[model samples]
Target: MTGWLLAAVALAVGFWSYGWQGGVLALSVIVFWLLLQFSRAMRAMRRASESPVGRLRNAVMFQSRLKRGMTMLQIVGQTRSLGQRRPELGDDVWTWTDDGGVGVTLHFERGQLARWTLDRPADGPAEAPVDAPPAPAAPPPAA
Candidate 1:
């Protein structure tokens, strides 16, 4: 790929300018960069694991902060938790829901955010789920 080609070119340049010593220096720099990237990912995952999966505190605020082309690690870092996978739609589809019944669905391609949508609760008061216990009946008015 292009990255490999650029690395090769850098190695060649380093060797051409200062022989083996330059090559070693260039390789060390490249390794350090890779290590830094790996460390960043580990940090993000650690932050994400502290919270419950697929849950958000403020879905609306998260939506507002979203930007196209964000990496999955970046999204995880922002949300502070892993999204719930939706593999039925596609391999990279995921969603997060808030306590208010709002949700956000996101689609990622090549590990970068391709598109996303915010799903809000429908108009009208919230209703309990079908399996929820029925409300108690009110007592008759006193005479």
Candidate 2:
């Protein structure tokens, strides 16, 4: 859509320039616009393929925050479903936008409890505490 709009504008300018020069100027403008669109699309495709993990991480973080907000609703009991829904099950995700304009969706099951946190990545390994104390021994049972 954007490409078409750009092409239309370029074509108009080229047609206007044709009176002074010739059809060559118009043709050049059209070619330039086409090349620009092609390059923009290629760059977008490259970015999409380069860092899929990073993209997934960002989405997880966004959804995690949304889940936290839904937790406050007090839905009771565990969730019956979660995650992206299948076509057969119908769409079961709710979306909201954060202050920064990032959109997030929290997927949930029918009766399950769902929660999100804005800490680390959902798949990232947790770091253990350096000065963790040993477990305490249980007291003897009544004799």
Candidate 3:
């Protein structure tokens, strides 16, 4: 932002003396800077959290800690897109897994997380029971 301000001021000065072309060049630099800033922000959001529990803490602190099958509008409110729709298994079911293998499968009625399952074992196997499937890809919204 500081750099942008300085560049803006410089552009104005250039417009005053160096003509339209110089002003346009300065404007292009400012535009590029803005784009760079936007890309950085997007990247930050994508890699924001590897644990929803911690994210939940940041979004809204809980009295105790969250458990499996917990449902909330925020859904831990992590920066990454958590909506993984899978209509084949059930309607409006979504899954969100982080890099750390901690995952949550959410069942949505409307736009809210109605039911969820958090899978994060300390020393157990990665795959859960055969009857109960692990977190799968969620289907797209109904047209």
Candidate 4:
């Protein structure tokens, strides 16, 4: 809706500047770009809303599998401390364990650990148990 209005405005301006043919072509390209961007933004917003829960569940499931395999361990907890900056679209924290080792970290914009990285665990003993913290509260909207 907003996209259409903006596109209409652009078309009107383009027509005024370069006549119908140029305006139509320019407007078509601009509209196409705007629609693509809008869809991507919508998907990102949805995914960000759901990610903390999804990460917690995945981490818990992985921990359970590890315990089943004679690896005495617990899910303990998970946390998603907000990074200093927002992550790019489709990025979030993830945790997993395998025969090689257990690991957890953020999956972010350009690469993993865009914010911080926890030290890798060794076989000796688990570090201080840290349960996952509650998700951060959403900020209030501006008036």
Candidate 5:
């Protein structure tokens, strides 16, 4: 991966510039950076675990905050919970639902968000069933 390549480059540069001591310094720095990243990820996961599965405070707000190419970790951090994986749909499909029964389905490709859709329960007064016939129009009043 890119991270590995960068680390390798850093090691090579360090050794080329100042011998073994520089290489040791570069390795230490790299390890420290990796540890920081790991710690950050663990913190996010811990926070997320405090919430219910697939449940967020406001799905609409979450959807609004979403941008293309966001990683799964970023989305999890925003939602404060890990999404429900929908492997039946695809390998990378995940869904998060709110208390209102609204759901946001996300599709990721190559570990990045590709697209997402929000599913909201229908609101307002109920309408006639599909099988019901249309009601006749009322006659107009005489002029």
Candidate 6:
């Protein structure tokens, strides 16, 4: 309502000062700016709808925060992709960016959790599901 009132006032003033031609030009400029703003908003919404991008729930964001010594299963259960890019999961390193924009990095050694960190990359990767093989069996006992 306020914006409309302001625009009306501007239109009236433009006509009084410079006649119809100038008034219409001024109004066109205002309309152009509004259109630009609308376009940007729609674009942002469309992108978000396509993928899990932009703002997210706090709990969902924390799922990426890995604790030292967490199993691969536990880590995967926590970290999730924040946007188009998903968390990259590997036997050696697991990387992801949470909704809050914080990076969750988990490094493993021989199927054991080695390190956990937070480092957002320029381009984050999608979350990788963990499917680690069972631990190796112990050697047979001597005769």
Best prediction by lDDT:
5
Winner on TM-score between 2 and 3 is 3
After superposition, the stretches of candidate 3 with alpha carbons farther than 4 Å from their true spots are 49-143
Worst 10 residues of 5 by lDDT: 119-128
Model 5 per-residue lDDT tens digits across residues 1-143:
89989999999999999999999999999999899989989988999999988899989999999999999889988998999999999999999999888899999999999999999888835768999999999999999
Query: Each model's TM-score, in the order given?
Result: 0.80, 0.34, 0.35, 0.31, 0.83, 0.37
Predictions ranked by lDDT, top down? 5, 1, 6, 3, 4, 2
Order by TM-score, highest first: 5, 1, 6, 3, 2, 4
Predicted candidate 6 versus true structure: per-residue lDDT over 8-71, tens digit per residue: 8888888999999879987997898789867865655554455453233343355445466766
TM-score of 4: 0.31
Candidate 6 residue-wise lDDT at 125: 73
TM-score of model number 2? 0.34
- Evaluation by lDDT, superior candidate among 1 and 2: 1
lDDT of 2 by residue, 77-126 (tens): 11212233234533444443333334344445553325332323345466
Q: Please identify which of the two predictions, 2 or 4, would achieve the higher TM-score against the true structure.
A: 2
Local accuracy by lDDT, each model: 0.91, 0.45, 0.59, 0.47, 0.93, 0.59
Candidate 1: pairs in clash: none
- How many clashes does the backbone of model 3 have? 5
Tens digits of per-residue lDDT, candidate 4, 46-113, equal 55455433233333334333321121011222222112222443344444333243344434333323
RMSD of 1: 7.9
Give the runs in model 5 whose Cα sits over 4 Å from its true position.
123-143
